[model samples]
Target: MKLLDSGFRRNDNKLFFLTFYDIASPKTGGNMAGKKKGRKISGKKAGLSPGSLVYVGSRTDEPVRISIMDYDADRIDEIPEATLDDIKKCMARDSVTWVNVSGIHDTAIVEAVGRLYHLHPLALEDIVNTRHRAKLDDYENHLFLVLKMVIQEPETIRIVFEHVCLVIGPDYLISFQEREGDVFGPVRERLRKTKGRIRKSGPDYLGYALMDMIVDHYYEVLDQLGEEIEAIQEEALSNPTAKMRRAIHDARRQVVVLRKTIWPLREIVAGLLRGESKLFQDGTMIFLQDVYDHVVQVIDTVETYRDLLTGAMETYMSSVSNKMNETMKVLTIMATLFIPLTFLAGVYGMNFKYMPELEWRYAYPSFWGIVLVVFLAMLLWFKNKNWL
Candidate 1:
């Protein structure tokens, strides 16, 4: 595996390089390439040293890799795998260049890129450690951005999170990704076809395009979530069982998590729009404004889903109450039907010496007739009351 270096002359006439690597090579030594050389410490001594480097991005057994795409309005070049020195030579030219860095787990390669680009240590740290919230940082010479890219796994609704770090300078844009695959295929196609304003624009426009792609994923996710919410609503209305209630609750929690994920994203995009960084040009700001609108739409959709889930919960409760009331009505009707019969049985069961009905043979039949009349009358009364 080779590192790409795009050499650009700084104001001091010093050469700065851009490095690219092909991570699939076994000769690259993978994670062991930059193993720290130091004595192992334990307990208090371990605490004395800086904490162990945490690898928060992609994990791959293959070597690190990089690719460079240098272009302008009339010229374009694609270097599949360029060495660091080769990239440096290209960067010295007047054309706009895009360096794509894939596989950031190797500390040596990451540090080398930082040094070449004169990136701040904290910025390099943020790039190497990927568990960062989405943000935009403006340095004097360039802008650094950290964003999460989400992709839906085929045949499944699950989302995979990938961190993409961007460095936007005057004439170049650097994209750092944890893994190899990306959604920028369309952008590359546009660049190749000279379609739209991409080729005519600068690095800022490129950055906008990439961000727009990322925001589009949010729409896809929101659509799926909306469909799920609708389905849950329908199920709740049709069959209000314990299982349905649990499902509604689970759906509500998922919506809450979705809201949490998307809420801050709006702010991040909004900050980019308002930021004074030269990395975003006037034309690009217009594009970012559109992106901000999309973000707002996403946030609105999430809130709507939350409200629907809440309404479903209420519907479930009402259904349960109605069920309980119906059960009580049936029980009351049964009690009413047995009342007169119970009284008649109690009267006949008594052994009173002066009881006229117990003395004669005809009395037994007549007593049953009287009990039948009482039961019929009570049934009619219940029917009139609409309790049966």
Candidate 2:
């Protein structure tokens, strides 16, 4: 869960360095373990609720770490720890510098970075508050972007969501992740190896590369969901148990959650592409368009899965109805066969000695024969009617 960043300039130099430590590091004090216990607080004290600091990203209390990558086409320099002096040095250099910070639990460090870059207080607030939705705000000097990075657990089919904030400045890019694990490994490797146009592009392209990685993960999650939906469909058809019903319901719930996460993302990316922002360049619009397309694909896939799950629910209901009707049909036919036979038994069990059927032994045999014949006749009728 270490953090790293690679910076590339138009001139082709690349610098790479690790930025932060994982939350489990000793410095974090294991604050991410569970919910903080407390008594109910009212009025001003409520503002200090432990949950006030929304744990929108990771539950880690890791110390904030920073790294700087300064590079130009000819030469590159990597600084493992990017202090205020390092930022000033990189700003004075004739290269593209990328400062990456990991761990947002420390508000002071966040404010310091904001102050160094002359970032707006609102943007700084958004940075410190990890629960903010995915968004892109354009300031004259830079673009502030908030995005959620999701990872699917292989064993549980559960998703863990994290927030990654980006500040695209004039000559530099600053990325902040709530946790240490980042999906930007490919982008890092590409920058390090000088693969493709990454080194040749500007800072906006770097922002696109990072955004593109986040969107790519949306596809992976949808793919996993598609598999799960297919399994639920099969289970609903073959053996519609109560467990299967619950599975369908849970699948639908997940679809709802996925929709909530993805639908707004479409708008956010679309806003970035449509609006005029200093962070986005004309050449970078095409990349943003690609990301936008990916968002649309993810949305469509989510919707399709939702529709399929709904159909499965209907099918399950129909199956249950058919089973109930079959059970009732058997009970009805048994009742129909016994009605006349029960009447005959009642007549014979009567205590009246004057009844002619009770006078002789032959009469008793005759009454039994009549009862048997009636029972057989009712069976034949039921069979003919296909009620058997």
Each model's C-alpha lDDT?
Answer: 0.69, 0.70
Tens-digit lDDT track of model 2 for 1-388: 3221111111122111111111222211222222211222123323554323322333444567788877665556788766878888888877678888877767678778888889877787677565567877887898888777766544332355666789998788999877555677777767777735777677888888988888897788677667667776776777777877777776676677668777778887888888577666788898889888988988888899889989999988888888889889999888887899899889888898688767777987888799899989989988898888
- Give TM-scores for every candidate, taking all chains together and pairing residue i with residue i: 0.78, 0.80
- Model 1 Cα RMSD, Å? 12.8
lDDT of 2: 0.70
Among these predictions, the greatest TM-score belongs to 2
lDDT of 1 at 323: 86
Off by over 4 Å in 2: 1-59, 74-84, 362-372
Off by over 4 Å in 1: 1-53, 57-63, 346-379
The TM-score that candidate 1 achieves is 0.78
Q: Residue 48's C-alpha lDDT in candidate 2?
A: 54
